[model samples]
Target: MRVDVHAHYFPADYLDLLTAHGSRHTDIARIPCAGDAEGDIDARLRMMDTAGVDLQILSAAPQMPYLEDAGNAVEAARFVNDRYAELVAAHPGRFAALAAAPLPHTDEAVKETVRALDDLGFAGAAVSTTVLGRTLGDPSFEAYWAALDDRSAPVFVHAAGRDLDSPQIADHGLTWIVGAPFEDAVGVLHLLRAGVPTRYPRIKFVVPHLGGGLSFLLQRIDDNYLHYHEAFPALPSTLLRRMWFDTVGAHAPALREAIDSFGADRIVLGSDYPYFQGDLYTRAVRYVSEADLPAEQVRAVLEDNVRAVFDRL
Candidate 1:
């Protein structure tokens, strides 16, 4: 079965948190929240079928309700996660989810992660590249990471905002175009510098946008890190191989590089739905076949890799 690990959907009620907390990013009016209602989800299912995606794992990314207020964060996590549980129960194989955890509040995040994975049966937890500028490997998130690592949970990682904390990119209208992949690269480098992958070896970190050009930058990252931190456990490039990257970008050279750098085992299917609708959405899936990979590796990217990364699914 083909599984897309990088699809997105936002629950309608959860969007209320945007106004309630004064969300800094995400244009509310333009959100493709068609999956909020059951009727809209039927449409999503039809699109998935048309795109040859047997299952689309949903996540509320770039708009994840990471409110600073613990109470609001907990509330937001509950409602959104509960809704995902509902859809998963209702649809069975057609949909799965990476539950939202209230972050920047470590203990609360831990509780929600436990509940979501241990109780709710989500495939994993969703987190942004940074939690209000706090790196995923920041000391504050150690407990939360520990909990996820202990549970052997897969964490779906993405850039939090479209422009991704940049002024130049936003002004140039290259926000989603250049910003997303740029943030992906920065996020991976941050985690590598902080040793998140080696420290939490059991935690499966699923990243998007062909790892934001990490495959190309691996040598530079290794050289820079080894120059100063030669005593670190291992090269950043070596540790990075442990993580999984989704095949979201259709660039064949990048896809081939990812396969060569990380191996076919770590490349998973990702449609990035709604954002790339109709034919563009289908291309997100079809690109793998067009990349001219072996039939076995193509099947691995489409089906086997995701299941291996999010084994709970």
Candidate 2:
């Protein structure tokens, strides 16, 4: 029941293919976690065991989409998903896979999503906040959202790596400081503001890194929405609390704030395993358990919330 919903793995062939292609655009190649040591499934599972995680939901790194060319991205997505399915087949209970799809290529992404879900038995699909710099709410991605809604699949909105042109890359390194969480927040905020959820209510979305700083900024976002309703008629009146988050980078204060704002049912356990911040999961959980949160709420965040989200899959 101790499910780590945000773990990652890439098959050897896929890794080799990425390397052989000399695809240097992705930060994964530059990031330590996406390197060879943590890229293997067995090593990731071993780390999970050490962290007291009983189940790890394996997902492809968001960098996989940097292939950019829709055709190439689709082919690579198929390979990655097929390999992910093979891994799940190899280890029934120990592992489950959240398949990847080639986004921006809505038709191909949808096709791959159905194949992965129906034939591959994948738990769900993983997509970065944006596709080639375009957020999921873009008109180009409506078809992809429609397909996910049709299947009622859970989509993991992971943060993309640092933008190659960003100034932060000059100051702080991509993996160490900003890349991941920044993209995560951007994706979540985009979807919330773009009316994706309102349009397709069945598509369950999970944002990691304690909602990627969203929890900390909820009041500001909500206040802005309230204040700008006249100017921004398209903004949804519902509170941002409708979105779900994971306790990945959250500490005690963050966790308490998220639970207080979003409630426990919407927060699940997430371990960005093998990443530099992997320990955040254990630390956050310990803090919650020790801080005198209701036993039932703590259990829900650690176990039930994940089951509720993934049970359909």
Candidate 3:
């Protein structure tokens, strides 16, 4: 019911820990949506009200724990996941959650996935495109993938901030502008190449930023696949149908392309709330409602699709 599926919220303790740990590699205060009391339920509710969102599936922002030390990452993950569980418990219908896990720490990530799903009752797990420079398609993550597949859990793949050190994209804030979307596209394409959708068909994956320009890039991927049929068992289009995308950063044209490519049932509402990209929340929700699509399609993207994807919650 009017679910904003791509909202982010960090717990107080987790923020403190992140502030204390230099290994996270960035200052929390520097985060765009940071410094706001994200864990404050009243503030969250007020923002949701203003945005006309009935519910929000809270997730960790890109500040997700992806450090080198497994122990530190695991501890941070527990703190984050526990805080998410607490929020979900404190406000039942207003908020749901996707558990945070220590990516790059394969075994611990798997364990946290189990606890988050089986014990914490989170709708899914939130993960980044790359884990400490390693793409999601890395062999090290097979067990982790298998675990999520076993439960058919939804995995929301969000883009971490771009790699600013790259020579080509270091200028004009391209890291946030171009690199973020680029990383998402690359990571997703890697998964497609690895046949992850075919191998672990049960895991329900959700990609943000309207599949991160994937609608526009699918043709290129298909062209490559056509040239090397032996390398690909199936086209990205085939596997993409098995996944879902959220309507963040997708305006009329992009959203239309996504619907044409991935269909309405595979799309859901996502506001990227409280991080307002020029009144992102209200404008995004309004955009869908006012789009040229039929009312049924709007309903599917705004409400029904989310219910279907995260049905357990």
Give the best candidate by TM-score.
Answer: 1
Which residue segments of model 2 deviate by more than 4 Å?
A: 19-22, 25-40, 163-165, 169-171, 174-176, 230-239, 276-287
For each of the candidates, give the backbone clash count: 0, 0, 0
Candidate 3, 29-72: lDDT as tens digits: 24444334654567667667777889888888587877678888
Please provide TM-scores, in order, for all candidate models, with all chains considered together: 0.95, 0.88, 0.92
The global Cα lDDT (0 to 1) of model 2 is 0.72
Model 3 is weakest, by summed lDDT over 10 consecutive residues, at 27-36
TM-score, candidate number 3: 0.92
Q: Which stretches of candidate 3 lie over 4 Å from their true place?
A: 24-40
Worst window of 10 by summed lDDT in candidate 2: 230-239
Task: Order the numbered candidates by lDDT, best leading.
Answer: 1, 3, 2
Which pairs in model 1 have colliding backbones?
Answer: none
For all candidates in order, the CA lDDT equals 0.83, 0.72, 0.80
Error of 3 at 178 (Å): 1.5
Please list all clashing residue pairs in model 3, or write none if there are none.
none
Among these predictions, the greatest lDDT belongs to: 1
Query: Tens-digit lDDT track for model 1 on 240-291?
Result: 7889999988888889999999889989998777787778888999989999
**RMSD from true fold, candidate 2:** 3.0
Task: Put down candidate 2 lDDT per residue, 1-313, tens digits, no spaces.
Answer: 7887887775555766666555664444444444345545565566666666788787886656446677787778888888777767877788788878877788888898889888888888788776666777798888888888898888898876645347766356664366677778767767866778878878778888877677777677767877866332244324345567888864777788888877889998887765633455456446657656889988898878888788743
Selected candidate, larger TM-score, 1 vs 2: 1
